[model samples]
Target chain A: MKRIALLLWLSLVLPLAAASDAHREYDAMETYEPHVRGDQSLSGSYKHWAHPGKLDWRLAGNPEENWKLNWKFMDPPFNASVHGGHFALDRGEQLFRELNAKARFARCLGAGKAGLKGLRARYPQYRADLKRIAGLEEVIEYCAAREGRVLQNGSYDNSAVSLYVASQSNGMPMRVDVGKGVMRDAFERGRKLFHTRAGKLHLACSSCHTHKVGLQLRGSVITTPYGDAVHYPVYRTRYFLQSLHLRFAECNLDTRTQPLVPGSRAYTDLEVFMTALSNGYPVTVPSERD
Target chain B: MRSISILAGLAVALVLPVWAQGLPRDAAVNAAAPNKTLEPRVVTNSGRLEWLPHAHNLTPWPTLSHEDRRPAPKPRKARLAGPLDGDAGRGRDIAVRPDKGYCIVCHQIPGEEWPGTVGLDLRGFKQRQYADAAVYQQIFDARVNNAQTVMPPFGTNNILSEQEIRDLVVFLQSLE
Candidate 1:
């Protein structure tokens, strides 16, 4: 009788204990781990992401000067031979720059979102149902991409332009003021766009990033959307100088959608919305990726 | 001894359904699908006009069309018939494996909370009019017809090996 009881306990109670222990581990992870990104708390700011001994973001050079700061974000972005052969060069220069090296810098969009009150007061009629319905045209013409002088080379003068602007906020937290009101509307648009599957693949941003955050494809991690925003101006060895907007355009291509011009109002809106979603994350600019 | 046997049997009965559903077959899947070869569109005499001014690995991947080019032919290499005798258990592992095909990302699978609605719902797949060959072909490479197909060329691009494709074929086809 004691042996039977022991068998029953072994079969049921022990397994139950293990399962509960696994749950406890998950719960502990939930409680202790500071969110790297995608924490979904709209009221939170990126300042809370300060984990004392994680990444040291105390550098003072642009991405062009200090590629060392983004050492962690580097994940070998290109097939050296393939990219080099295509560019008519020797197949070894991994740091080869494809976009314009003289690309300029602009203020971060999250800052613009934080200071949106002035714009709201300037154009009050753009408001609707407790939220600002600021159209893309108005946003584009008014701000000029956060005090950016439209460098001529047709919108996206190449990857260089994006590197310049995004490098300005390399060490800061990704802060977009989408707590409510106008920024919220933009965030909603980005959210909708993210969920809306498109093109030949019928893929939405949420399809990979949200639903399958840790899933892998082609030997690379399908990163979740939240923590992904701050690592802009990636020195994608495959594409050379890849900006966050250019990456969006590449994704548009991957999905078979007509890509919006980089630095366009559309991309800025999308960036603002994504940045707002990722409000409480650190900026890790000039990162490398495949 | 009798009580222990009964307890063990009960435990087996409880766990068997999940095990069966998750790993449908440990045995091999049949190679019933015929080879569907797609002709490459890059006829080289045109001064490589299809090539982008700069090769950023962006253009020339598939269809460069800006608009919806789905259901179009992919620019990847041709796929021969995949292997027979695939292990469905391994197939499930490959399907769920991260940083790879990520089939679960877009394709709704069992045991996932946020199964995507982008691709064909994997549920009720057995009821669909898919033949064994058709099932294998779609999963192996959906871009054969759709040049801009978002479904990766697992077979052609070598993302999933031929054996893995066969395994996925068996597992997916068995989804009733």
Candidate 2:
């Protein structure tokens, strides 16, 4: 009798415990909404469906007020009592602003009043520190590490985000400080790599895109690699979200070139190269494109 | 012997309800729900594979691979080329190649062969005033700007990791 009771009790209690653990984990993950929110790329409904608004909208930088959004009274599908409560929309926006202000490479030297024309003239140059090669994102990482007082979480780190925040300086000359040896090496390596061709397609990057661009081969136009940096974080029609590395990686795959992972050193180097190519172009994130 | 047999029979009857209770409520209500869908085909990049096993018929993928007698294909070398250098040739190749990274599928690159006009053109990209790195950063991940871009976050997409993107930058830079 005792053994039967114990076995039955164990089975029931074990299942209950498992259920609660699952629920708890879900709750914890929910707290990291900011990171995941970028993934949903929700349609228009996101503005209304997120957490409710709390009236505690403090003045900018009050410090004392608990950050939250202020939505008007509207009933949600879930709990009625919590209808008009707050979501952290304002808080998320605020953090983005704070991070943006301290971005690296905000005003790269040589960015004269003339804008991007002169800057685009010199590109695919080599860098020194990243002896292999470098690009805009790499420089951004270095700048963030050196000036923004932050860590370079690899290529797509938040520091990259901050660098993008500084892309407002479109139409300025590329002030790439090629003074450092490491910078020079990177610039040169970047140039050589740009010309090299390796893929089943047997075509170099310049073969089809630059020389034959605008001419119809299959059913597409070849595009010139200029003024691409000005519009980023662009809302594309096909993809679920704005993905810069995705485009870079996709291009490699298309070229039959070796594909590298998103956060790898090679990708970072390419990023720097492309940035230099579009030197003086102004940046426009949150851009919408078809 | 007779008494023991009677006791065994009683125990068998008593266990039926208990065993049934252990099943999920939905399962108990519809034990034949899985039978409704027959031969459902799941479409992936490799084409139509197989339908997911029923919940009641939980089976591992590796084991299923063996049972189906379909051997997986060998990995291709192009998928492993790594990353591109920042050059016009590389960027041009990227615009054309399909297996690595093709930007022309939905994007329009002016002066390229049959450039796609779905997305904005990349002609005169250098005209943007920001540093090359800033442009690279945008190419690295445009999600930081607008989240809803048909352009997959390639780095985030796992198709091409960060290093590959760096190589792509090299190819793109050479265009100028």
Candidate 3:
């Protein structure tokens, strides 16, 4: 009887002890201050030599203006509004509504169309029940699974629906909570991963994004990580719509490091860290990029 | 009963190896065994046999997904003891190749278009009058001077060979 009582007492107390230890680690962590400000433009003064012939000479003096012109020039053909119909946006909206109807996403999210305002800004959130950091994509995948449907993380359908839902919260600032629990741990891990140098090049994400921000690399300019996450699920001329994790994988490959699986815990943790840096920046889905 | 069973088990264990030695060794198994003396097998890709660099051929580096317990290289300063005798032209070729030195990725080299501005412009590097050994050390490991430098340790990390570093030094010294 005494042994049974001791086992129960140990089980109850052990978990509490472990929880406090995690909290202590969180308390000891140094606060991360983003290097780049929200207002600062990521575009640098470097001449866009990737396609010199395509550049408008009039906007040459102002790199920001030149970038805008270059971005507009690279807009996909589907972006055109034919006879008052915005094809890309309409398709995205249609797919989103269809998925919502099938999966009851409106009920699951505890919001209607109007109530979904600022919904996109609150993602890469820590779920107490799930006991892991869940990105917007992961949450959507979970909801879809409940309805007996599968939504692959980086697929076109996923991107389309995500872009549409994210567009709803367009102008709202990101508000990822990293104050307590597993979120704090994930944030710490993400920051470490970003700064840690690995691979054949011995390059950290900070090497290009933080240290070499505004510097040109061959034909392209390096952008700051701050305010960068806001415009993700961005439509690129090279590969239509791309998820943030997909882009992370591409960066991993560029550094000659084998990429972690998309939507994996490590990548989700990284997304949490990255999105937290853009805390004050407004979401800008359906954004185009060259 | 236990002693009789134990005796039988001991007898089987003692006879097992001896009984196996009487059998002929499989020729295929002997052929399949790894031999250090044998040349690396060429892989056939799209109907063409090529000596591509596989995981076995490449130098082991610390990768993101893998946990590397090896101690990281510390910043150190070392100089060549003799006069540099590397081919400047060959060095220039290596500097431009993306897979090799690719110095133009971060440094502005003369005659190179779309040069990156992350590192110092080497247009008049000859005028700096830096010692050849100093330049070699900087390329090998810039952390010896600046601990927070973003430049890759080309020599120390095995990204560039010592001869390649010597050639790069010669090429960098020739800039006027």
Which residue ranges in model 1 land beyond 4 Å of their true spot?
A: A1-37, A40-72, A75-168, A264-266, B1-176
How well does chain B match by TM-score in each candidate? Answer: 0.52, 0.46, 0.65
What is the DockQ (computed on Cα atoms) for candidate 1?
A: 0.03
For residue B164, give model 1's deviation from the true position in Å.
18
Provide TM-scores for the models: 0.41, 0.34, 0.68
TM accuracy, model 1: 0.41
Candidate numbers, best DockQ first, in rank order: 3, 1, 2
Question: lDDT rank, highest first?
Answer: 3, 1, 2
lDDT of 3 by residue, A80-154 (tens): 323211234456577667667754775555355566778888888765646667887777667666666666666
Measured on C-alpha atoms, candidate 2 has an lDDT of 0.38
Q: For residue A219, what is the lDDT in candidate 1? A: 34
Ranking of candidates on TM-score, top first: 3, 1, 2
How many clashes does each candidate structure show, in the order listed?
19, 145, 0
lDDT score at residue A31, model 2, on the 0-100 scale: 10
Cα lDDT of all candidates, in order? 0.43, 0.38, 0.62
Candidate 2 deviant stretches above 4 angstroms: A1-93, A97-164, A167-174, A177-180, A240-244, A288-290, B1-176
For model 1, the local distance difference test gives 0.43
- Candidate 3 residue B141 C-alpha distance from true site, Å: 2.1
